[model samples]
Target: MWPYVAGFIGGLLAAGMAAAGESYWRRRRRTKWIPQELQRFFRVKDSSRLQVLQKSFPRHMAPDAKRGLDQWLAEQGLAARLVGVPITESFINTTGLSALMAPQGESWYQVSSVEYESFDVGGDAPMECPKHALWLLDGGDAKLALFWTYGTHRVGCNWVERLRIEAGFVMDSPGSGLADQVLARLEEAVHSGHAYRGQVLSLGGEDDYRGNASGVTVHRLRPVARQEIILPEPTLALLERNVVRFAEQRPRLRKFGMSTRKGLLFYGPPGTGKTHSIHYLINVLQGHTTLLITAEQIGSITEYMTLARLLEPCLVVIEDVDLIARRRDESGVGEQCLLNRLLNEMDGLRPDSAITFVLTTNRPDALEAALAARPGRIDQAIEFPLPDAAGREQLIKLYASGASIAPEVVASAVRQTEAVSASFIKELMRRAVQFHLECRPDAESAIILQNDVDQAIEEMLWSGGPLNRALLGAGEGREQP
Candidate 1:
């Protein structure tokens, strides 16, 4: 019985050791086989070894880069030979003893590539991709081979799609010049602003802004006209002169020794027309790109600045800026660092760069002194105060332009809405229109009478309680200043 037990234990130990050895060798062979297969498939000659250049990009931008590079190669009259290699679950699972002992004809690289249609959220388009592809281009004097693969990148617990590109050339070719030309073309294709024009880009990512491609969500913005924004004449004039004029006459400003990059601060209560005014600006500057960064995305402020520089004549809007630009000493180290980055980026802008930094905050006192107190950083600080009687009247009429409200009703509502914001007036007009619609649903030409306006004003201002006033952006009329 003792001999039988000893023999059984020995057999178990041997089996475990054999399995471990087989596993190690399988992984080793699997890793070595792919590169060997790539070399053989390309028929890389003994006299000419492969020189490789590699780059990685967010999966979203990879297709664009590949297409751009392919187009560029075709334009240069280079013939492209494409070979795709499939990576299947069976291949991955068999990456042990089975892989090592597999015949050359049965290798993973020999498998025919599978193509799939990938949906792009950026636009209404579907792109095609294989699991992995190698592109060979004949550059007359030099032969270039490009390889691209798609994979998942784990960022913390989140998985992000990533694309890796590797380019190989003959060792005897003009390596530096050829590589630079290819890389320069790729860079231009990747950074081209054609894709982001007339769209609002919000910063994305956990800690850093990865520029337009990797860390951004493109928003299609609806253009607002000048008449839609109600502000004091002087404030409108200031915005036109400082922001609009700066963008329009950037070259002229640079020629005159004036800095083309201007920073404008909009400080006021929540319900004022600060953001509305920004929308108007966005509309007027139709050709230029606009970047909208919320307080939560302030961590990517530096990245936003970099993009602004690249996309010149760009508007960088930072809403609720006081969240990140708090006084240095009173804030945490991270907040202070963010404030410093903001100042540095603003200061580092070239005079000829037509980049406008538009920052808005309800609390100006909470901002860092270096940002607001400095002269060069903030070129203009425009206060967006609550609309006075005249402004409110104009806002009511403007918002009620399509409605059947009379001028007298608007005038009456304006008189009662003192210290209310342009937003409040707009909401009042909206409620009045709704009331009229409810009372006379079948009346296509129903008029919004003074009684409707009066009822809306009373419900929003007097009877609906403090919460209603706050919700409609009426209670906070005065700026802290």
Candidate 2:
């Protein structure tokens, strides 16, 4: 009984709507409301009547089209004027790529049909269509489509149905595979150390993530990891011992005052591959989060305290502590404050806290005496002195073993250099090989010649000796000026 009653009601409602629509259509069809331009294009032949009716029609029909067109039409005394000039300009630019206007005796005819267009507005610039300009079609409508191109190009036209395009021309659609790609790309950027300055995941409004290529580069204050970079079997074994001890024993050792927090201070000559070793550590310690901070980042001692305290459960690296942690009296009051702040933060972290602080310095002696005195403050101080022959050979292998350098040349260069850090040796090899290659671009591609290595060594012996001497002197001295 109820089902029949519901069906009867629905049928009556449908019939009433149909009757109303039919009546409205009949009335509208009989009404004399033809547009002048349309009538002219159709060749209605009643030009005088249309002109009279058009002249009487209000001048402000298309608000966005009227400004420029109204002026033109007013100047020409057209039968009807178009409004909304900016909107119309955008409409024409987007839809027709170029709108065609034909003189209809008393009015201008718009020949093209309306089309949707969109522009991706994030990143450095907006996405573009060659012939079409994307426009805002729905002034009052919430959901808007954007796309514009000259009418002939059909390829980009179909993409207008997608909701939005994220950075790098990626389109996003609901329940679609492409949307997943966009989200995954964003997640990769975030996880791979790209810091989000803005809400990047949300696509509701215009703003997207804009930041440095690798998020924030905290000026690493310490060696984020051990910097005594050596490929020697003995050195590797020693490092492995420490790493194994830390990984395996750290958990049990925590109760006996041994901390899960590890600190390695690399005190050695410049060019000892201290920086390179840190990079290697960052690469190896994949599971753990790391933050690199330098002394230069400590604007005032106060800011250092704040940053260090905040970025906990992370590796805080101080790159050159010989410059930053110098004795307070040896430098300015500002330097003293910075050293103090660093000291406080280093001492402040709890024993079991996840944060690991690594400080690197060429001159450990120049550091404030008391800074290193705090027990458990600096758990281990590993030194990276000038590399021995074996270390040099390993470094040469690492640096020049890339597909570009010839293996024979790498061996010859490694053997010739004396007592230089891995860094200096690599620099020499890089410069010498580059010079040799550039000098003989058309020559057979092969190992860097022994002659090239000798020349580089000679150049460094004469021209570079002074720089090294100066650095050695500064390392031993009170301060670097």
Query: Which predicted model would earn the best TM-score?
Result: 1
Relative to the unseen true structure, what is the C-alpha lDDT of residue 198 in candidate 1, on a scale of 0 to 100? 56
CA RMSD of all predictions? 7.6, 22.6
Question: Which residue window of length 10 is worst by lDDT in model 2?
Answer: 52-61
- For model 2, residues 1-481, the per-residue Cα lDDT tens digits are 9999999999999999999999998975564332333343323434232211001101111111212222332443323311211124322223221121122322232223433222332244332222222222122211112222221112332211111112111112221332233334433332332221111111112232432211122232234344335655665565555543465566577778766766667677777756676665655554444555667755433433333333333455678987767876688887876677777767776777655666888778888876665667777677677777777776666665442556676677666665666666666767677767877888665466677777776665555456653443212222211
lDDT (10s digit) by residue, model 1, range 1-481: 9999999999999999999999988976665444455455445523135566777665555545756776677666767667555555322121221222235524445424445434232465434544476665666675666666666666554555666666666666754355667767777766775455455666564332322234456665677888777788999899899888767788877889977778889999888988888988988986777899887666666667766776677999998999888887678898887777777788888877788899999999988888899898888999998888888877877888677777787778877787777778888888888888889888767577988988888888768677778877786443321
Assess candidate 2 and give its TM-score to the true structure: 0.49
Measured on C-alpha atoms, candidate 2 has an lDDT of 0.47
How displaced is residue 17 in candidate 2, in Å? 51
In model 1, residue pairs whose N, Cα or C atoms come closer than 3 Å (at least 3 residues apart or on different chains), thus clashing, are: none
Please give the clash total of every predicted structure, in order: 0, 36
The TM-score of predicted model 1 comes to: 0.77
